[model samples]
Target: MSDETPIDFSSVLASAVHDMKNSLCMLIQSIDQLSQSSSHQSKEQAEELARLHYEASRLNTNLMQLLSLYRAEKHQLPMTIEEHYIDDLIEEMIAKNEIYIEKRGLTIEIDNDEALAWYLDMDLVGNMLNDILINAMRYSKDTIVISTEIINDELHIHIQDNGDGYPQEMIDLIDLPMQDLNFDTGRTGLGLFFARMIAKAHKNQNKEGRIMLENGGKLGGSVFTLILP
Candidate 1:
């Protein structure tokens, strides 16, 4: 018999999930077009369609996180750090999310120094921000605020919302590594876990990036902070 074993099941599963994500993207586009063309007279139909689109978008986000984590664990993920203007990144994200925010009648305010530049993996950072933005969208009451600045030689980015904030249990769990699959808060905890992993991946010289949770911010909501050095 050959030395090589059968095909790896994990690899197969990852590939399948990747394919499904792409298909779901197409599905979302189709649904979005249909929803845009439909008349607003059918309230129930429009609400159902909106829900379907949101769920599909959420599934796509989860699949992406899974794939990225898989590649990261295998040391196959690329980390390409480059100097980028912080304001441009925030602007791009806001533009992409405008519709989602408007649909919920929420307002987002971004505060940052116009000249601040940072060296980091743009793609990974973008994904990390995307996850945070999605979480804020889901939990925020009416407003979201993102801010960035340099403090004590470290770059800090904060995403905060105007909601009741996270439960005490979740704040406590931020420091601990993810070791359980059974979540009691009805939250999957995947986004925070994924954010932690990405933050830890950003290292410079001897310093590594970190993520933290706090109860109070400008918005009086849960704050997700990422620090990179």
Candidate 2:
């Protein structure tokens, strides 16, 4: 009689996600090289290649988030808090998706102070910001604004777009607990859940970080804010 515990499928899924993430990284690189090397192709071909690159990049980002969330649930995620300039972080994120932004004829406006710094897990926060920015670019009409401020002794980072705002249901759903999120619908739920978890991981003086989603900002569209104490 052989007695063995049942294998946890979740762990297997996590491992698969990690492998997929690595593969996607290579695939994105290849797509980038192809786009660059085949610049002399027809306009239609170029556009198609650009679309392929963007979708691959987005998928890679999603897989990374999924793997990180899995690690977080297992209490294996390590967060390193360090002092970093907000502007520097934003610049890196913009540069990362610069090609896609340019192809889409979109613009990003920065209103952050060059000297404003924060203590946070840069990798985690950067990933969250990049994902939010990528999603914003898809919905923004033309201009996307990235701003930073200090409000009520908490550091606030805002990403606003000049386009139709988020659907009312999504804004309402964010207020509920992550466990209550309906994953059967859209990617918004997963992205928001990951962002919320990352934000709440930071704490200081009994204050934890949080995120907010509101419509009707300076851009008259959707505004996403990350507040960290």
**Which of the numbered candidates is closest to the native, going by highest lDDT?**
2
Please write out the lDDT profile of model 1 over residues 57-167, one tens digit for every residue: 677767777778777777877788889998888887776555466566688988899999998887778877877787787789989999998888899999999889878
Query: Which RMSD values do the candidates have, in order?
Result: 2.8, 2.2
Model 1 clash pairs? none
Q: Best-fitting candidate, measured by TM-score?
A: 2
Cα deviation at 163, candidate 1, in Å, is: 0.6
After superposition, the stretches of candidate 1 with alpha carbons farther than 4 Å from their true spots are 1-5, 8-11, 39-50, 177-187
TM-score of each: 0.85, 0.90
Cα distance off (Å), candidate 1, residue 102: 1.6
TM-score of 1: 0.85
Total clashes, candidate 1? 0
Over 4 Å off in model 2, which ranges? 1-15
Model 1's C-alpha root-mean-square deviation from the true structure amounts to: 2.8
After TM-score superposition, the amount by which residue 10's alpha carbon in candidate 1 deviates from its true location, in angstroms, is: 5.9
Candidate 2, RMSD to the unseen true structure: 2.2
